[model samples]
Target chain A: MSRNIRILGTGKYLPSKIVTSEELDRKLGLKEGWAAKKSGVKIRHVVDGEVNSDMAVKAIEQALKNANMTKEDLHCIISTSASFDQPLPCQASLIKEKMVFKNHPIPAFDIDSTCLGFVVGLDTISYLVEAERYKNVVIVSSEISSLAINPNQHESYTLFGDGACAVIISKSSKEETSSIKTSLIETYPEGVHMTEVRGGGSILHSRHYSEKNKTEYLFDMDGRAIFRLSSRLINGFMERLFKDSGLTIQDIDMVIPHQASAMAMKLMRKKLDVPEEKFMSIIENHGNVISASIPMALHEAIVQNRIKRGDKVLLLGTSAGLSLGGLVFEY
Target chain B: MSRNIRILGTGKYLPSKIVTSEELDRKLGLKEGWAAKKSGVKIRHVVDGEVNSDMAVKAIEQALKNANMTKEDLHCIISTSASFDQPLPCQASLIKEKMVFKNHPIPAFDIDSTCLGFVVGLDTISYLVEAERYKNVVIVSSEISSLAINPNQHESYTLFGDGACAVIISKSSKEETSSIKTSLIETYPEGVHMTEVRGGGSILHSRHYSEKNKTEYLFDMDGRAIFRLSSRLINGFMERLFKDSGLTIQDIDMVIPHQASAMAMKLMRKKLDVPEEKFMSIIENHGNVISASIPMALHEAIVQNRIKRGDKVLLLGTSAGLSLGGLVFEY
Candidate 1:
């Protein structure tokens, strides 16, 4: 029943428009160094004309190329995102359309668990591959954080960027396989309101939507509250994860934690007690791309030689579900 | 590698507000009998104050009760829907919150493929169960289509109803396994535009939402186009499905297909050569409940004593992915 679902390739796409912390501060009318000092984000990508699926398609294409495979090789496409280009048809379908995989009609869908989307997708696909239901499954986490963040919300506006990450998952050959050791996802719905877009759903139906209070539809985050709540359980959660996986912190090569915020990441790293050097951080340049953050960081770590073959990497993050999830694998 | 995933129980929730076609026709300023004659929907449930998660939780509770289980028995909760009460915390998370399952902290997420949402979830949970990842998973499809239908778009408005359907999937005992014979989902991204709500996603950013194109945010359907596109493939798709499952059309006791529309249902039944008695239809009483249509129909069939323990049942549907999917199993 256990099988190694290998990560064949990883790829990411960042927008062209780069917004520095100082620029964001100016836009939000905040003190000059307040933005950068509060959040470690120096510069982040902001989309202008591109959409969520556009970025996802680009990342997926790169993943396919990196895996040295073509569209024909993929048996399924799973898109993970909190920021959708549209609510209907699912973003995966849009990505499939944009990618021009018309000849290959695969099962495509979107899984949303807020920021833990990528990990949720990874966990789900790992099982699918393990079950031998699919051979080559493409998983993409794409986000347009800029579209969701309210500019008036100074704290959130300066800490979000638009980006996407994609990975191709398949059963490894007998000679080489990345053993996905353990995958765990737990959600405490009590934390659902820590981060939310109240007006963006059926609650704010189009029939009742008013131009007034338009900003309510944008993303809202109680950073301090989330940090306080998540920090309390993170240590215990990490312990459970390590215990369940039967691996100690010392066995991990690197930890790819969600770049939630500059402060949150620092605190989590300290609490998890992973060596500073062993933690992969990308928020300084990419800010928080929500679901894409983990995969984007993982992709960068591999490219920068922080993770290599035979390395044990743990992907971790907290999501809007008040969810904490991790995927431990040998790279 | 293949194993049976038994459906332990089935449940459905329909809003109390029943709007007859004549009432809808009057409200939409259409001629009497025009609405019912066109879509053959005599009545459909419309939510007054309840949201997607509200209905979903009710259905799930009923399902659990029907299965003679408690919340403690569920290892995971997967929700399927194109309509969300909100976009941030995933409907499954919201359901968890509303259902008072915060104590369990199980993995929760949402999968969306428009109307194919339920089928996709079924395919997914089956693999997960077959892989022994989870013992009992609750899959619910809750949709408030009444919130999305454009009153101005007569065709769509008359065809949608707010409802939810839930089922408990678990490992079947050796003596009672309801073998899931075949589960196939194919999405032709080419049809992503056939049915959609363009205004709810990043495409229609909240910041730029205009009241002028207000109706654009509601569900829009090109029924003729979807019928034409789906008709060309349903026969072939069903043939392939029967072939792969090692079954035949004659072997199936009943088919619970998505109640897309009365016209689409009749045409599909004729084209697929499924006898009128063999095709389970509920559009007249429930309309098209989007993702909940198939499950709701199946639940109704079970309640009406149409599906017995040893009968072969086929769940089929075409969704916004312009996707056609089918899952065959023995009750």
Candidate 2:
């Protein structure tokens, strides 16, 4: 656990097109407002013409500006995405190509924990920063999940969006109090197949595709199964996380949970007993952006002054691994 | 840069079926021995009905047995795969499920650097082991790349095999000399598209599949482009790597290079001036197993007793990112 790393800046990028739930209701032939009522998503961003890496680069540029740093200052780029830009070369390499830092062969790679990518990236890279191997690093979670949405899977169809969120982080000075308290990510494989895309991998090669198996290539989820498994484990997972750092839920000044869904968020917040004002929510407009959810919500919280420097903040999320991840840090 | 981490054990698993070049000659209607002459592959393994994670778990089980430990001893599972089991929950989660270790909520994730995945996985996880965050970590690189090879593309079709390689690594005590001397991974994004699967991603969603764009779904490569770019950079890259570690190639007792292609391996070995006796080669039988190559080669080298404990070892490779990685560690 690296205790002296700090997040210098944060930024997010959402695709231009917005699809309101009412529009989805009309498109899917559901009753008016039914889509919004079912998914609790009012308007969610969707990509009309943008590619994933281009959107990731835009978010990186914004983060660079926020941190008052340029691409030249970065020691490495860790791209975190549940959905990738391409199937080969890894996502960070594609992002690095788009950044076009002519002579900088900055070390880059991908760390994916599905929706928990951003949190895991932070935890993994903090050790490197603490070791002083990388002085400044950019961790970006970018997802073009809308492409994986199967229109026929009505439950998940209206509950997703496309976006990218980025953060520039560096080693804090000895005098600065900025640091991560602790973070834990635990995968309970009991729910491994609870959410998945069955095609496009070795088990079911995408080239074998035909109209008969289109759903296999798209995102499929048993939302109730995930919620049931996660709810059964969330209490113990969080208890272990806080106990590891010797901190409690009350020590957290703000709770930044993955905006999985409006209902899921509300339920988790109430279950955790975090005050309403302290819990962050972006799902109403952003939908569940997969890995980008937590970071995007954190970016919004920072922009809105909900979390300040030295404030104790906690990021919590349940990802497709049926993974539970929580991180408590000082902003 | 973690100096005291030691590889406790290593293992590899090749699928049951071996496709010989002679068989390919008959199958593809090419001249006898033409496939062998061109691809330099005698025989290669291909999965019949096995899933990627099952192969990985088998390899991990072998590695654990070699280490005199069990799955219960693992602190984390870091799965490295250029090709995945599935696109959703990640390869690690799937591997965990198959391990079936009840009550062990192992923290798991996926790290993909294309063919360089094994080297990158080791480098990244070394930090965690050094920090004592994880006492024992299993890093496995599994690839079922034969599924991605398009028989229509003669070059890549003859060049790939499928296999899994695994190693258990832990912290070395004060008396042990086992340590990583130095490692450097530099990604020159200039050649991002030199090799790729342009489909099954946001850019060309697999759902948009059709016979017209079928080629996009399979592995496509401009071999000359990658070789040309890599050759221009390898000397400087190796020079910097040895310079950083304050050691020359002469100090290394064994050299393990990625089984990219027999020609690539030969050219790289000759260019680096490594004696044939000290260089490791397994491409003849295994073919270019993508991400599983280096680790698979390393496992073979150790099994053959060509390198003893405490000997200096170097693992080097180039992947789809046009990324060059070099690691000199004490075995």
RMSD of 1: 1.5
In model 2, which regions exceed 4 Å deviation?
none
Candidate 2, overall lDDT? 0.89
Clashes of 1: 0
- Model 1, B1-331: lDDT tens digits are 3467788888899989999999988888888899999988999999999999999999998999989999889999999888999878788988999889636878889888789898889888788787778889999999997877878778888888889999999877888858788777888876789898888777886455566877667788899999998988787788767775778878999999999999989988888788998999999999999999999999999889998998999999999977888988888
Using lDDT as the measure, the top candidate is: 2
Fold similarity of candidate 1's chain A to the true chain A, as a TM-score: 0.97
All candidates: DockQ = 0.76, 0.83
Alpha carbon lDDT at A186, candidate 1: 87
Off by over 4 Å in 1: A207-211
- Compared with the true structure, what per-residue lDDT tens digits does model 2 show for residues B131-173? 9989999999889878777787777788889999999999999
Question: How does model 2 score by TM-score?
Answer: 0.98
